[model samples]
Target: MAEIEHPKPFADWETRAYWEGCGRGEIVLQRCGACSKVQHRPRALCASCLSGDIEHFVASGRGQVYTFTVTLQNNAPGFREACPYVLAYVELEEGPRLLTNVVGCAPDAVSIGMPVVADFTAPDRDLAVPRFRPA
Candidate 1:
């Protein structure tokens, strides 16, 4: 299989814990203390209740493929080499959906409602990215 070069992810004050958790081979999410809602794309406040009481925790890294597309063409640097890759929205067991690549299988083998587990890329880098594969 061809290796896909993953660019480094950016981290800010509000998202530092998330990036750090990824580096440790974990998926981090935030929960609102007020509304008891879980969310992704780490933020300083809750998107549901707009409350400042937010807490971070490691996620199960398991989910189902909500939707997906097989990319047979791309001219970008890293993606060009990774033609025929599967990009999908994985609905986490925790509630939020993440836009990520689904690897470790053929593109045609991926389908909606398929079970998957998180996989990390660039673990040696400052931040790792979460990809998904068949569980």
Candidate 2:
């Protein structure tokens, strides 16, 4: 099967650490120093308490398939060739639900609540995209 050609992800000040961590084969998330709430899609301020004291930490990379769907059709360049892929929201053990793909298995084999672990694509120009696979 042809791999989906993911577009290179660029990082801004808020997400620089996350992109860097992925490049290092680690999944990183943010925690609020004030509320101690963990979040993904890295941001400068804590979404819960609006605190600027957010800290980045390496996540365990373990999660479960919270929900998912198999995309049989996509007109977009990279995705079009990768039909029948599993698109899922993986609920990380750290509390963030990352919108990622579940690979390394048939789409029909994936299910809700299935255990999974982080898998990263080879760094393309210094950035690695995170995905998941059955644990």
Candidate 3:
């Protein structure tokens, strides 16, 4: 079996809340205090209003698959064994589209609008990757 290559937080102050929320089994999204719009890919300022007044909020961990693909080729050595996996863009309940892996179903069975819920695994690691399963 190939070694598991996990995701770690970016070395930036603005991303601290996101990683910390994950450690606590929470899904955090950035909300613009000015425009009141929620977004992902954590940053200091809101993408819409460019306002530095932003706050962190936890999501419901429920979403629907906006799009997805079945990856049959894993070029990376660590992920080679997990090939033929499903990578999806899930439109979270809080409004941000998140890139995540869709598990608990056949790779070929994944489809648009399929409901999914967040599942946290191995939180003790330096990095905790959020996974999803059919709701």
Candidate 4:
């Protein structure tokens, strides 16, 4: 069997800190310095305050499962080996939700409101993706 290559995530100037932090084992989230509202999806302006005073901060990396789906199949290239994985929306303790894979447990064992912590996968030197597992 051949090793499967993982998909690399995209990072732009507005969100560079996040991927960089992930490589360093930190979960980064952005906060609006103007109004103090924190958010994810790493945008230029705040969703609540609409201010451009955004700053990235390291997060606690603990969250509850807001939702999830068990992926029994993946047609995309390099993703077949990842079948039977748990894809989930984790609601962070810092008040943002991140779309991440829930690992370290059976797909059938995942549930909404389940406590989880961040894990990381570094496929290359330049990036790392955050995953989650039951806490």
Question: Which run of 10 residues does model 4 get worst, by summed lDDT?
Answer: 1-10
Q: Model 4, residue 25: displacement in angstroms?
A: 0.6
RMSD of each: 1.2, 0.9, 2.0, 2.2
- Write out the backbone clash pairs for model 3: none
- What ranking emerges by lDDT with the best candidate at the front? 2, 1, 4, 3
- Which ranges in model 4 have alpha carbons more than 4 Å from their true place? 1-5
lDDT of each: 0.90, 0.92, 0.82, 0.85
- Please give the lDDT score for candidate 2: 0.92
Candidate 3, residues 1-135, lDDT tens digits: the string is 232465455536888788777777788898898999998999989999899999998999999999999878877765677877888999998888899989887888889999999876667654456778899
- Write the residue-wise lDDT of candidate 1 on 82-101 in tens digits: 88788899999998999999
Model 2 clashing residue pairs (backbone): none
**What is the C-alpha RMSD, rounded to one decimal, of candidate 4?**
2.2
Q: Residue 2 in candidate 3 has what lDDT?
A: 30
Models 1 onward score TM values of 0.94, 0.96, 0.89, 0.90
**Against the correct fold, how does model 4 do in TM-score?**
0.90
Whole-structure CA lDDT of model 4: 0.85
